[model samples]
Target: MYTRAEVYSPLQNTAIWLAAWLYSVESTDETVAALTDLGGRHSYGGQGLAALLLDARASADLSSHEPVVRLILWGPGQAAGLHAGSAAAEALGPAGAIVIKAAGGFSHVLVPRYWDDGVEWRWFEEKKRLPEPSWLSPGEADSLLSRATEQAAVLIEAAGGTRSDLPNPRLTVGTLADFYDTPGLPRGVTPRAAKVLARADRVAAIVETVTDRLGDHSYDPQLFALWRHIRTARMAGVADAVQDYRRASIS
Candidate 1:
């Protein structure tokens, strides 16, 4: 796999992820089908949840470089027991990037640059599940994304998973990136999501540079428009159009 780095955006980030998912699935041996299968697990990555799959793919970027961090209980009470994993991807504020995950009646929020800013993700009313190792269908990516976030909030409110609390949630907990990393990859044929992944890295750089230089300014709509253009071009089978994406991202 190629190296990809990114920071989440408040607007249109999901679309960016779908671009990546579309790219990855295309690269899959079966091209968009691998996302539909979890090998036999209660997975959602392969499910056709539309925006759900897109979000999951975006969340997966959170762990692309870092190892999965456990979201063990951070609060008081047995309600805090078990592995609670809610992964948060931070956007550019006046500060730096942040990633927060909460479950197990608790939460863990981390800012890559500042540990002090890191906070625990607390229980919220929701339900999220990891994509299981079962066989998957191509269309499940959207569902998996939606379900994970939904379950994450519920697990927090429910006080983690059904099992007893673990000393470290990361040990038992898994993220979208982690779930996909587990075991062997199912095989077939694929298109190519690499460009999407590549675009993520480039866009991230653009965001950083823009933020550092622009400072608290509303990003030009053209940036978003460019991103949309990239997505459309890729889906339409015009791989070279990424050059247009590169131009838009940099300037």
Candidate 2:
């Protein structure tokens, strides 16, 4: 049986809650769009999972862990997979950190304490440190996801969407056409993004593969990595191509 802290730990804060809300967005393009909206509104300290994953150049003290968290929520499609010595694992450590995945590609990560010594804790203590979550539990993840879903639902409805227009069960697709149509994605790339995009053909293939996965009712971690590359390259052509593919999927 999982403990309460294990569940709520993933909630992190309002920012993570917001990210969870966005995660409930089923379409990758729409997910990216919602993330772009969030990045525009928040800074590093408060950046949500989407902002951390999509913006290549954006840096945060805990940004290194984003990939791991991404995998936890998404999949093991990361090229290198999770590295025991990497920043994400180290930050998460063995200190009761856990990742939970559900049907429909919905997932989350939780840690009992942020001050764990696994991720160079000595340095965090000397400079800046994030706080530990005090309100998490084994079964609370469902409620967190629900709350996030409700909030996201309200936002989408306000923008001319209906519950039936979205996906069913675990998550739904929201209206993010306005967010995507907006100009100027933030610039920045992470080391992982550079490696993934190094082979443009591979990146394109992964996009196609993940699209298929979604059609079959699955999620892929590589999809998340691809979005990171798109944000880094600022390749509107690629974004357009993805949007085109999405449109076709529904048509």
Candidate 3:
């Protein structure tokens, strides 16, 4: 039997992929179809990806020029590529962001708001000059991947390896397996970038799976440290993947 990673798309950050895809290509029927396929994975408030794209285009005049798209992945202690105290940065405190830079220096940042019902999109217009995102170089990306690999190993060892049965599991391995087994990547994504993204997705899945198993016991000092390590590693992998994807798209 094929491993879950082999069968799955390994694209965990959908917003990043979507933004990069939009930046790379024109809004054709194919683009819409691809968006629909990816957006269908999430539960949205309105008409989903189509509506979001339509609103963005209408409000920002995005069609006039191909906008620059940058993905921002933020957490409690980490806010890479975001200016502190800015509306866009504050709005995207924990959840990630997709920043679209249109003509005439118009910038629109889209942040996802998670509610009990579903996920919704929130747009914040950046009037002030936003700081340029600090992108990772190819070597930096490789270093990050190496760190992620080590962290993944540590997490797996600490979690006593993967468990098939856990009491009241929040996210089952099966569910994640199925969830990731979908279409991933946009056109023009380089093979290297795709590989990096796949590794990132695998590390992220490991983090989630192990965290679910720990449950309430995740607060244990040693376990918590291990969790933090894996989480940080996963974030690094994701950030590198995003940088690689952007580079591939632009180059």
Candidate 4:
């Protein structure tokens, strides 16, 4: 198992969590096909989700070294959003990254810095069908992020570590774009629509589509453009391109 020091050191100043999810226990590959077969569009299968998690799992810098915190709740109301089992938690225990399960109801939680050894697990009732986790609205999401940032700052202070001591996790454009386009991923943009937006000409259309969907909320077209560029750069693995986009966002 990973020590608190190992996990906390890498996570110091970062507010965002480096997270991965297993949407369901179902497998198209035959194993547990009947017992836990959660169905979905074949294109958006476990392969992509698993690949992302596997990459992070293999690299400490991508996984545990990134900024993250874990919170747990025991007994009742385990129907919150996405979840995984003990086996998954055990697999990640050595890295000090926690698997948050069940509590999809009581607000988004920022896992505390100082916690005891060993990973904790929570399970849901088998009979009840729960709604898949969806992105929170802009206001709700912002509130959650604010609370999390404050909590992270306080944890850093208690550890006698200055904010400057910790570095922001260097996130890929794809990941950052996902964060930027909140309340509309894994659902809002279908795999098909995502492919359509891959073309240069479709950029404006996608932007317009998202803006329209957002209704009367204040929206920034430039930020959306920047996000699109960043996604392109990260997908292409061009660090300089990503940096250029980031610089452009502020300028």
Global lDDT scores for all candidate models: 0.28, 0.29, 0.51, 0.26
Encode model 2's per-residue lDDT on 1-251: one tens digit a residue. 12111111111222222233333323445444544443333233354444434432122222122221221211123221233454444555322333322233323333323332211111111121222222222223233333333443333334332234333312222112222223322222223322222232233333332233223213333233343332222222222222232333345
Candidate 1: regions farther than 4 A off = 1-117, 125-195, 214-219, 224-251
Question: Could you tell me every candidate's TM-score relative to the true structure?
Answer: 0.22, 0.21, 0.63, 0.21
Quote model 2's TM-score.
0.21
User: Top model by TM-score, which number?
Assistant: 3
Worst 10 residues of 4 by lDDT: 7-16
Model 4: residues with Cα > 4 Å off, grouped in runs: 1-129, 132-135, 161-251
Which candidate ranks first by lDDT, i.e. highest? 3
Q: Which ranges of candidate 2 are over 4 A from the true structure?
A: 11-81, 93-251
Give the Å shift of residue 202 in candidate 1. Answer: 0.9
Query: Candidate 4 lDDT, tens digit per residue, 1-251?
Result: 11111111221111111221222121323322211122121111234323433332333222221122232211122222223543323233211222222232222222222223321222222223223333223333334333433443333234332224322221222333343233221212223323322221123222332233222123343323233232221122111222222333345
Single out the weakest 10-residue window by summed lDDT for candidate 3: 1-10
* Higher-lDDT candidate of 3 and 4: 3
